[model samples]
Target: MLSTVSPRVADPNVRTALVETAARLLAEQEGLTIRRLAHEVGTSTMAVYTHFGSMEDLRRAVRLEGFARLAAHLDAVERSRDPVADLSALGWAYCFNALANPNLYRVMFLEAPIDAEEAESGGATFAPVVAAVQRCIDAGRFTSCDAWSLAVQTWTMVHGMVGVVLAGVFGPDEMLGHLSTMTVSLYVGNGDSRAAAVRSLARARRRMEPHAPIKRSDGAAEFERPRIQNAAP
Candidate 1:
């Protein structure tokens, strides 16, 4: 005889379990609706709303989590000693992150609506890539282009390659190594002159940072937030 597990125990752990179950189902199943998700997780729609606000909010949270994870991968890539190699590693990390979490990646990069104004305002979300590019500049590895411009150019190259690979425009085996080399070469270049602007911008950002605090919260000490210029294209 199979034992039955009742979900309606009046326990906080039960409620937490329900929310996690629902979140997992959402990630696994694309286009999941609140009602369907509620049923699968053995909870009510009200429970989902209580935990996550709205369906849109839940989606946003999921995408935000994905971006945070991707950011961590990029961060690790940036920590490498070799600047050129770090950039290449970052490109590889981007592709790997997207491929590993396709649905989450779509929600993070493709489906999430990015505000043009927020992007133009140089929001916090774009800081990691900007910081990475700035490092290359400071090291005299790249030309001194503005951080924003270099960030956009470098990001575009990586994003475009990922898009092509995901869209099945190229076979998996054919593009991986070739694209990685090509992307690194494209940005760092055959000569050092191309990166002059990059170095200058990095220096400028470092100098300017002391004057501007990016965000403030109630009763919290003021701190400088890294400025990430809009590179979303």
Candidate 2:
């Protein structure tokens, strides 16, 4: 039997516009209404319902969009013989994604409620990080352990720091140095020597610096979030 498709298929351009607008509204702490959202995107109010079913569904879509973009960034990090450096690069990618898409990042983790399948999709996005952790174990940079568990621990450490910076506890300029220190410490705690961890992270940072965001003297970010295409859940 052929799979059934929904009769009300959404235009990808409109979907992208709606999701991006919603994320930005959330970041700016503005109220979201179907009418306002539709007006912002030059569409009818019914278009919101036609595309997303309801506002709650739109929230879920926005979260999934965030994960999709994160997955893309993580997948772009090149692998190398040095597993520790590769792992560090993955961490940097995660950080960059969060920084680049603050509104979507907040929606992904903080604002919205995700259903069971959506939750699974979010986990799938983290697979690259887990794979990097497994590489470290395979190379004996980390002790034999559950790579998923180790990845979770390392991920949460970075996430907490990101949250702090996002909340303005620290400026963006200060985040990289603190992140470097924390990342090296986590690697050392896992089994790598401190010196080796530092060297590995340095390698990754050097590779990342060319593309990293530059902050203006007034604290505005030179890097803005890219418009991401929505992935099917």
Off-target runs (Cα >4 Å) in candidate 1 are 1-31, 40-43, 115-125, 188-190, 193-233
RMSD of every candidate to native, in Å, equals: 13.8, 7.5
Clashing pairs in 2: none
Shift of residue 176 alpha carbon in model 2, Å: 0.9
Per-residue CA lDDT of model 1 for 30-85, tens digit only, reads 55688876787777788767667787666655655666656765655426554554
Q: Determine which window of 10 residues in candidate 1 has minimal summed lDDT.
A: 224-233
Query: What lDDT tens digits, residue by residue, belong to model 2 across residues 170-189?
Result: 75557777777778778888
What does candidate 1 score on TM?
0.61
Question: Looking at model 2, how many pairs of residues clash?
Answer: 0
Clashes within 3 Å, all models in order: 13, 0
Compute each candidate's TM-score over C-alphas. 0.61, 0.85
Residue 5's C-alpha lDDT in candidate 1? 94
> Highest TM-score, which number?
2
